[model samples]
Target: MMFDPFGDFDTNGYLQNSLRLKDPLEVKESEHLAFEASLEDALAYLAKRKSIDYKAVLKTHEILFSGFYHWAGKDRSELVPHLAVFKGSKDDPRHTIFERPDLIRRSVEYALELAANKKRFRERPGEVMGQLAFAHPFLDGNGRTILLIYMELCYRTRFAIDWSNTNKDDYLRALSDEIQNPFEGHLDNYLKPYLLDISSRDEWPEMIGGIKGLDGLDKEGITYDNLDNPEVQQLYKTYRSQRID
Candidate 1:
């Protein structure tokens, strides 16, 4: 029975993969490089797209992590199929169940809908983020993936978070709280003070990389969704058509 929560890894604790890193530090370095490269791909993709949606979210993940994980573009519902959570407080923290696999598409589409409205996105960015975070679509790369997508959403709205000035501890704590009580806007309150006029997307990767990348949130393991029915395709189509290309 394998007991590693991070999936397959070498004896030295590095993620088992082509780069053959020997430890967490080394693995992080490799992932940073991969993220930097993918950030460019994501920017190019966003430039060509008419609007963002759940598929764009998946493409962002695929662009960022495809070099590292074979399942980069696939969400946990498709790859890991089961109930998973961020374990805490006596080994079981209170958590809202993640969107079941069959509902993943619809859940993300809903988030995209919230994000597409500039006024609502600016007023309730945390709610939009929390909904997507609760969805927890992918097994790995959720933080990085979501951050990039959120930034893109902000770009579309003509705003940006001056992440350089944001405190990591406060942001993470608020994120956890937001995840626990999504509609309260705790994360938005924390982030709103840092919001600024839009900036160049080209600078985002390094700016994000400087913040230490995605760390401290991986305890939540991947899970699968056994729900049989899928919805949201039609809704997504209607939503996409309504956007002002």
Candidate 2:
């Protein structure tokens, strides 16, 4: 689950970072630092936006991680259309199968489509989140990027979740379950209790900067396989069947 998508881990470090840091801890430190520096700007940028789309989503990822990853904004379709990304060993029952490269855009668009109905989105933010998480558009920085997009969606809709109160372990568990069982309200059930009136965007810089484990899903248990693998192909078909429309 090292996520050596570029196959240059030994020489260029994880995802060929700017400093070529090899240790996972070093990589984590560098990424989190970069994420913190960009959080305020990212929040402010979202504050000005009237709406967001896949381009905005990619831009958010670029803004947050460009300092760490040269290919920060590019999605899987552009970077590695031939490989499939997963959260665990492909054969494992709990492993996650992200959207295929060709369908990544469709996945995000669908999430946005769901968010268009602000009332429904307010009630079932998890469905939107689960869709984006399933897309897994970027090689890295996906969790943080999607959070920014999700925040903007929440702000536009005038609602928020108390990330401060939510346990990272429980949230991730619900997200994983939600991804596997899309539209079943797994994430909505978990998030409903934490829903509250939206907080000031000014408070977000510190609040988001203080939240831990934003990278929990990104840093570990990531592996990739060739799209041609029969098992991998079968998994995509299964998940595609679950996709609405």
Candidate 3:
């Protein structure tokens, strides 16, 4: 019952890795490099796709972390069905239930549908982004993966978040608020000020990397091996069948 997911540090207190690096700083540095290198390929892959669905979301995760984690493209439900995850501080923890994994798929699909509307995408990016964050699909890397996907959605709709203008603390706070009260638009309001016309994608990876590489509000992970049941698997199959690509 290890409550801290990122606390699985090796002897040196560096986070343990699916890859060989044992030094925490080295692991962090390597992951940053991996993300920057993979971001272009991920964006290119997105360009060929007609829509961003759950599969595309998984693909983004894969592209971003495949070099660092063998389980990059998989969801928490599949990898650790019995595990529970939480974000936020000890006093006000936000729990994520892996019991009903299909909800993750539904949330992403719902976000994509909302994003399909240029008006809603422009006016309520927070709502869309909040839903995806609430879904919390992966064991880790959800923030970075979703941010890229969110940016891509904006690009398709002809808009982008000026990451340069955004403050990391403020953005994280807004996202936390949105996660807590998802239907509300706290994140949308926070982001509205920074939303700008679509700009070059070329510098986005470097820009986002500098802001707070792979940082997310979610905290803690504990695994329970027997969480998945037949019904959930069926739901996943149904969702998988609906993917556009």
TM-score of each candidate?
0.77, 0.96, 0.77
Model 2 CA lDDT for position 152? 83
> Candidate 2 residues 1-245, lDDT tens each?
36798998999998999999888888888998898888877877777877898888988888898899899889999999999999988889899888889889999999999999999999898999999999999998889899889988987888887888899889989999999888888999999998888756767776676566775458688989899999888898887677553
**Span of ten consecutive residues with least summed lDDT in model 2:** 208-217
Span of ten consecutive residues with least summed lDDT in model 1: 222-231
Question: What C-alpha lDDT do the candidate models reach, one value each?
Answer: 0.68, 0.87, 0.69
Per-residue lDDT tens digits for candidate 1, residues 4-64, read: 4355555524333347565556566676678777777877887678988888889988998
By TM-score, the better pick of 2 and 3 is 2
Give the Å error, residue 165, model 3: 1.5
Q: How accurate is candidate 2 locally (lDDT)?
A: 0.87
Over 66-140, each residue of candidate 3 has an lDDT whose tens digit, in order, gives 887777898876765564444422222343333245466877888889898889789888988887886888876
Superposed on all Cα atoms, the candidates' RMSDs to the truth, in angstroms, are 7.6, 1.5, 6.7
Best by TM-score: 2
Clashes of each: 3, 0, 1
Can you tell me which runs of candidate 1 are displaced by over 4 Å?
Answer: 1-16, 20-22, 87-90, 94-97, 199-202, 212-245
RMSD versus native structure for model 2: 1.5
Clashing pairs in 3: 82-224
Q: How accurate locally is residue 185 in candidate 3, as Cα lDDT from 0 to 100?
A: 84
